[model samples]
Target: MTVPLSRPAIPVLEAGMPAPDFTLQATPDQNITLSELRGAPVVIAFYPADWSPVCGDELGLFNAALAELRRLGAQLIAISVDSAWSHTAYATQRKLHFPLLSDFEPKGEVARSYGVYRAKEGVCERALFVLDGNGIVRWAYVSPITVNPGVDGILGALEQMNNSTQQDTP
Candidate 1:
């Protein structure tokens, strides 16, 4: 009998590490550079695809939580191996107000840099990275592909980051 091997477990980013910066297509016409958003909190949601059921639920939750995320000084961006065209269609269909970045072409390079790319599956493992204004990761979590990790964790991390940042300032 032949045995099939499971994919290697991908690692999640650790808190206090500087985030990896990348320029990615956010729409059919626009591109965004991660480092350009410095001086503001940024939340990166890396998922597998555009139209998958779990992805839809997760992205929609972020969409609904947009105001709360903004109030906490966090800007959310959804990244996937999906193409810019795919992201554009998916975002429009879901009325997602946030940018959906395409990790296509070089495909998963950014995700791999963050240690969230699944090589065997050719997709980004469902993961979250919340970075503070200084671009240091405040929190991160990688969930099962079938699960939605929820916004509470992200919000809590944002609060903690805010407290720490305030303490560091005059």
Candidate 2:
């Protein structure tokens, strides 16, 4: 018989909280601001680092999902504590078209604000936040650091939000 294992749960920021606005380095010369991407759904992926094996596969999966995500009027912006240069190299190697914002310098400050920082590991816990066009968080999830958490939950949130917006339209 296999014994069941359990891990401590990490809390995720609750849905309906106003996503704290932030501007972070996206490239050597460019910065991305959360508020600037309004008028479309935004998927914020807070992962641990740039080159971890799981992180690479997780982001690669999102890269593959970009078309579907865009069709729903959603943009994917991944945030990690890695520096801009590191992010650039990682994105190049991974062929990721989405912006990978750096939470470097202060290191995990944005992750802390979102309640996803893993101080012991000096990285952000695996977390996902789906914000509506107006910048209110619609759904959130915290996954084990070694887990990917996939894109189904995000796709569900985008579909639900899109449907609601349609219903609200005249």
lDDT of each: 0.90, 0.91
Candidate 2 lDDT over residue span 1-170, tens digit each = 96543322344578999898999999999999999999899999999899999999899999999999999999999999999999999999999999999999798878888888877668888899999989999999988889999999999999999999999999
- Candidate 1 lDDT over 8-69, as tens digits, reads 25556789899988999998889999999999999999999999999999999999999999
Steric clash pairs (candidate 2): none
Poorly placed runs, candidate 1 (over 4 Å): 1-10
Write down the lDDT that model 1 would get.
Answer: 0.90
Clash count, predicted structure 2: 0
Q: Alpha-carbon error at 148 in model 2, in Å?
A: 1.0
